[model samples]
Target: MDYHIYLAGEIHSDWRDQLRASLKEKPGVHFHFYGPQENHDLSDAIGEHVLGEQPNAVYKDLQASKINNLRTELHLKKADLVIALFGEKFKQWNTATDAATAIALGKPTIVIRPESLHHPLKELSEKANVTVDTIEQAAQVIDYIFA
Candidate 1:
């Protein structure tokens, strides 16, 4: 059986690319990255706002739409487990929400935070089925548990 892992983390281009490449090495596991097709250079935001002006309602609506879409993709259908990757800082606004949704749905969840000592989503992370400090460790746990 194949395992579906929803990878959530910071949006920096290099970090994202590196993590994706690393996680893709896991055998029999599929990694899904949210918003991979979107432009990450703030171009999308700039295009949405003319002359640096965006309506608050428009922003809220777009965020809601994105969140709903993530829920549909990550929780309702695709993900067998959720993995939130963190670096030095734990900036997990949307990632935390997705993890919470996965837990609420009774699916397995894990957080891979290597550099963080105090995570903002500490409570939620602790409540997950398991938590590890690295993607490699997470992969090992997955293999052992799902083997």
Candidate 2:
């Protein structure tokens, strides 16, 4: 079965590259890299490695009323799991939103936090199906979910 995984992390952070590499080894997994559009080209990177498909911009326009609708629709249409990268930052709104949405939708969700971070992703960690602190641990979570 195909798994659509939503990748949550700080834009422009090195973690995105690591995530891309990790997911590349898991062939059938498709990723939707979510974050502020200006800071990074995560979607493009994922597209290059996977199917070269991008999210629908017409649907993702950020007007307050439409953004959540678009996100929900995308989740319904494309996601089976949500993988959040909680790096140096404790947690960001987008990460919270993605994890919450995934939980509400009954999708399997994992939150990965770097141990170096000062604060924990307490709320997300509490809700996540699994939580880890390293790329290796994250890969193990993926293996568990996809195996």
How many clashing residue pairs are found in candidate 2?
A: 0
**What would the TM-scores of all predictions be?**
0.64, 0.63
Model 2: worst 10 consecutive residues (lDDT sum): 58-67
Candidate 1 TM-score versus the reference: 0.64
Per-residue lDDT of 3-115 in model 2, one digit per residue for the tens?
Answer: 56667656656775676677535566555555334333443243333443335653233333244446445754466767777666544666666677777888788788766
